[model samples]
Target: METGKSYFFVGIGGSGMMPLAMILAGRGAMVAGSDRSLDAGRVPAKFEALEKRGIRLFPQDGSGISDAQQVVVASAAVEDSVPDMVRACEVGATRMSRPELLSRLFNDSVRRIGVAGTSGKSTVTGMIGWIFDRAGRDPTVMNGAVMTNFADSQAPFASALVGEGDAFISEVDESDGSIALYNPTIAVLNNVSHDHKSMEELRTLFGDFVGRADAAVINTGDPESAAIAAGLDREMVLTFAVDRDANLTARNLKPEPFAISFDLYIAGDFRQTVRLSVPGRHNVENALAALGAALASSIPPPRAVPALESFTGLRRRFERVGEANGVAVIDDFGHNPEKIAATINTLHEFPGRLLLLFQPHGYGPLKVMRRELVAIFAQKLKRGDMLVLPDPVYQGGTVTRDVTSADIVADLAPAGIDARHIPDRDAAAAHLVASAKPGDRIVVMGARDDTLSLLAKRMLDDLNR
Candidate 1:
């Protein structure tokens, strides 16, 4: 957490790690790191972007850990066999997990708003950060996705904003059990479902997360979160919901093809009619969570609700790639069952056949949620819609291969869902383009792989051809 100290991140180019590295570098810290993707030239532009910010780059080989004085930071994914980790051990360097580093920095802030949930963490964090920034709070913000509102010529990857304000806003992780590390002035739990852990484990983690906060903003729509809210002191908890009665709620919900409008209400009194450019009912829930947190920070609903009107949304969350030949394509970062369900449900709100090209983010995640995912897609996808998949992304990690994308397809087949496995995204894209008809909405969904966005654009070009 020292401003002027040197730190080395093992996987620096990752969405979570990159933002923290940039934040430190902006704070006058000597920041440097290495990534397998950067070393393999998978995403050279990301590395170049980091270098432009004065961050030193190194190969994954032990080259970066030259001195013991440099604290080596690594994500939980970085195994012991990784060269940088071995080098840290060899040099007796102070090694810190990515969460620990983030927790230290986050806890040091005068005011902190921790956004925690299974899904919508990144988007809600971005929304809250944007509101605070637009309200002239000048808050330092960290997010897993790039905030389009903060994007500019110099900072294309505007994931982290270094501000001079007292408030520090960040999306905390409950998947890796890192949410317990943060003690926030306001904690926001959007929803909790099966993602990286079991329901029991999630309840324990999220329960502790909210319990430690000075005040908590709970989502009543999510049963698990609502159960947690039941135990909290009424004075210490603020509630938001679209389903049931709550302190704050959204009523008369309207979902359009590319946007949704809802009447914001607090304690059954209508506050304002809020319109979000972003698509999906899930985003409506996210906005409510963001507004609750904003109110927790003393920003009123009138000012907070207006800021959501201009929220352009984060990258890959139902982002429109382009339309060609009257067929529209969207790029989304939905891998888990909840996220995938949300995306599919959102698309259903409009009248169009869907060609869902889903690339599983990781083999491990697929193995964990395979049955639930199969059930979700089977239940949500209409008869006219089709589901396609490449293989689960293998980024040179050791994982169980028993559960493949083909397994999910097999499970969906019995449920009358037309699902296919192509094993390669390029092939999947070609098949999708060939099968897509006018007015079909082709949604490319996944996470972990940065190339998904590029693939989405490629699909648009292919359709145009």
Candidate 2:
């Protein structure tokens, strides 16, 4: 319940838990954690970084919890049956959910901003943080991906940075309903779409997230977010959009193959011409949401717009891995139905046959959005489009094996999509590299695995050779 305590995390290798553990370790707390993945040899580089931070790693076998004084923290993904969780409870240790622990520390900051959205959350989080950093305003920023702007020798773009300044910025989650814990000075909602929760649940969670903030910045173009904007008190809401009348809107949206550019407008008056190093109209929309957050923090448009242009984008979210011998390989973190459609739809504006390599994140999620996923690929992919799918990325969690990429392939095949399941990363890469032509965009798509980008780059190298 207090500071200066030794803490043990059940899933330390998780994106959310690792950053929080690192912050706790940096704050001089004795922090150690364990993960089933660490034993499985996934994300070994991340574990090495944590070890360098003086945080020891352990197996998720409950052996790490040696004393009652050591608090145990874990994510909702960690089951009660997990050995670490069982062991922590056996020792009468205090346990906290990842969000619960983050809230306690995050709420203590003078300026806490939570960016909530189904997609574009990571990119918007990174954009806001970069604005603050470029302005010389040291702010603690927590993001899901490595922000290119924050990539440097000392931090190595650690997903989160604990700055010496008063501001605390984090990407909140409404899909898991963990966003309820956040009490923020400014809250930004990018857009609402399905992944883990129902639309009804998401609407309430996102609406309530905005209500908890002193001021809410929302995307007016999105119907779900616009509904939240309408219900908010005039003084409490700030809206951004590309079409509708909003406090901030991007007009003249021009999207190219590799990047998107638009003009920013406020209340029908022209503000500035904004350019993004990232592609798609979705990214342009993301930039507007980020601009609103910076404006809410009293950072001028001049500073925010330049920072947005300077943004090289996050680790995923349409990240270009390599362009070997004119074959461009992209790595994107788009697993859900809507997000997948958006990425595919946007690539239509570019110059290439959309050669998509989709690895489902898990069997359960792929099953949950099975029909929608099938329809998206069937609708978006063209005649010559190619799809390479690996089996669902699952290590331990129980899932119905019947529900898989094969199911999606079966559905897509009926619609004439050249889709097949390869079931392994290496074969998928080899097949893609061998088949890719000069104008094919070889995109590796999925989430939860940090090494997908590396695999995408390797595929590009193989194609070049």
Candidate 3:
């Protein structure tokens, strides 16, 4: 949180690390770091944007860490055998995990809003940030994905906003049990599902998270979240839902291809009819979560609702790249079952045949949720819908690859789904592009890898030809 200190990030280009580095640099700290992606010549535009903001980028070699005074920030994925960690240890530099530093900055704020859940965290975080910005709160925001509203040519990766206000908004992570680190003035729990952790472990983590906050914005529509909300004090909890009853509810649901609209109700009275540029009934749930957060932060319904109308959404959360030759290509961060279901269901609302190319984020997650993943695909994918899977993303780490994308495809075969496992991502993309036809939607889905966006663009280009 020190403004004048020097900090070096080990994986600066990562979704979580990039934004923290940007926040530190924006606050007048000397920020420098290295990423394996940068060294491997991937996502050059992201690193270039960092350099433009006066952040120095270095290769992942040990050369980046020299001064003992520099604080080295690394994610959990970065092993001790990595060159950066080795150099930091040899130089006696201060070391901190990415979540440790982020939690420090978050806990220091006078008014903090922590968005947490298995899915919709990034979208809800972006929505709350945009609401605050539009309401003239000038809140500082940190997110895991690029908020398209804040993105432009100069700041293409606008995941973090450095503000002079006391309000700090961030999406806290629960995958690594780091959700406990955040202490929020207003906590938003969107939903709880199976992803990266067991149901029991997730309940405890999310319970403790909302329990620490002075006020909580919870999704009562989700059974797990509703159960947690049941235990909390009624006066401190603001609940939202799409179905059934809650403090804040959405009615008259109407979903479109790229957008959705619904009526917002507060405590049994209709407040306003809300429309989001982002698609899905799930996003309507996310909007209610953001409205609950804004309400907790003392922002009026009029101000928050108008801001959400203009909310453009995050980069990879069902982002439509472009349509070419009558085929539409979408890039999505749908690695988990819950998120993937949202994307697939949203698209199914329309009449297009889905050509899905899902790249598993990592082998570890594939191993954990293989059954759920296969079940969701089997249940959701229609008869004509085609699915192709590439090998799980492995970034040279020591991991147990007991399960792979091939396993998911094999499981789907029993359900009569047309699924294929293509090991190479390029080959998968080629297959998807070749299979795409008029009125077909080619969706490139995954997380943890930045190159997926580029692949989506390449598919659009090929379709155009």
Candidate 4:
């Protein structure tokens, strides 16, 4: 909580942990951390970049907890038996959850805009951050994914930006119930769907998140988000919709394989024609949410539209890896049912056969959403589309493997889908490469596992050969 104090993150390279650690280091704090990936000698480049920026990196051993004066920061994923946690206990260092520390820093800002949802939080957060930055607000922004707009030679993984301005923007997480921690001046709820929690629990958490904001941006297009907004005072809410009437609305929509164009209407008045470089109708909804949040913060619609138009996209969301011999490879982070459905729907707008390699992020998610995931894939993927599955990526946890990718593949086969369970990712890649045709589009989809991106590249190389 104080400057010049030493802080060590337990899982520093995690999507949520990395940006918060970077923000602390940028604020002149003594930042250092350890990660399991570094311990296993995987993804050394990300940690090496942190080290070059003056943040100390160590293996997940007990060595990072050098003194009692340091504050040990960790996420909910870190258990008590971990070496860093044990060492922190022995050394008497003050321990804090990553959310707690992030909320502390976020609350200190003059104005805060927090984006909360079941999906598209990272993209919407990046959009708002880019809009504010382009408008010369110089806002301090935090995101779970790398913003392509901010990626450069020095900070290739530019997930967080430290700027001198009144606004602090971040994507708040409800999966861990950390969305309740921060009180924001402007809060944007993109959509509420089942991810890590139940519908009742998600509704309660998101409702509280919206109720706490001075001005809330509600997505009326999503029934759950609309329900949450209905309970709150209508005067304090700014609504955005694609289907019905709202304070800000998107009309005359067109969806392409890699791009979309739409017209913007503010309060039933024609504002301007907006175009997005990103695909999917969901991204159109995300743009509306970002626009509403910007308007709620008193930025005019005209000023924000240009930034949204120029917004390229995030790193893994519908990112094109490469193309060779009429075969193209795309890397995406769509593990949950809603996310996967969105990506598949976007792909249907184009005319290419899909060869999908999906890795479930965890065993618990597979168990919880197995039926919904199967139903989604059955409905979205046509007969020509093929699905390949490997075992879920395990990052050292005791989990119940009650349901697996094999079960989903079995379910899909009965539904007329071309699904296969290979178990081994390497074998799956080889099979996909061998089966790929000239017009096939290879899509690598998953989350939490950073190696999936590398696998996407490998598939592209094999296709080229």
Cα TM-score of candidate 4: 0.98
Clashing residue pairs in all predictions, respectively, total: 0, 0, 0, 0
Query: How close is every model to the real structure, measured as TM-score?
Result: 0.98, 0.95, 0.99, 0.98
Put the candidates in lDDT order, highest first. 3, 4, 1, 2
Pairs that collide in candidate 1 are none
Among the numbered candidates, top lDDT falls to: 3
Tell me the lDDT of model 3 at 379: 88
Give lDDT: candidate 4, residue 236: 97
Superposing all C-alpha atoms, what RMSD in Å does each candidate have to the true structure? 1.1, 1.8, 0.8, 1.1
Query: What is the per-residue lDDT of model 2 for residues 125-242, given as tens digits with 9 covering 90 to 100?
Result: 8988988998888888888888877766666647888788888999987766789899999999988877788888988999888998999999989988888888989898889987
Winner by lDDT between candidate 3 and candidate 1? 3
Poorly placed runs, candidate 3 (over 4 Å) = none
Give the 10-residue window scoring lowest on summed lDDT in candidate 2. 149-158
RMSD of 4: 1.1
In order, what lDDT does every prediction score? 0.91, 0.85, 0.94, 0.91
Worst 10-residue lDDT window for candidate 1 reads 39-48
Model 3 clashes, total count: 0
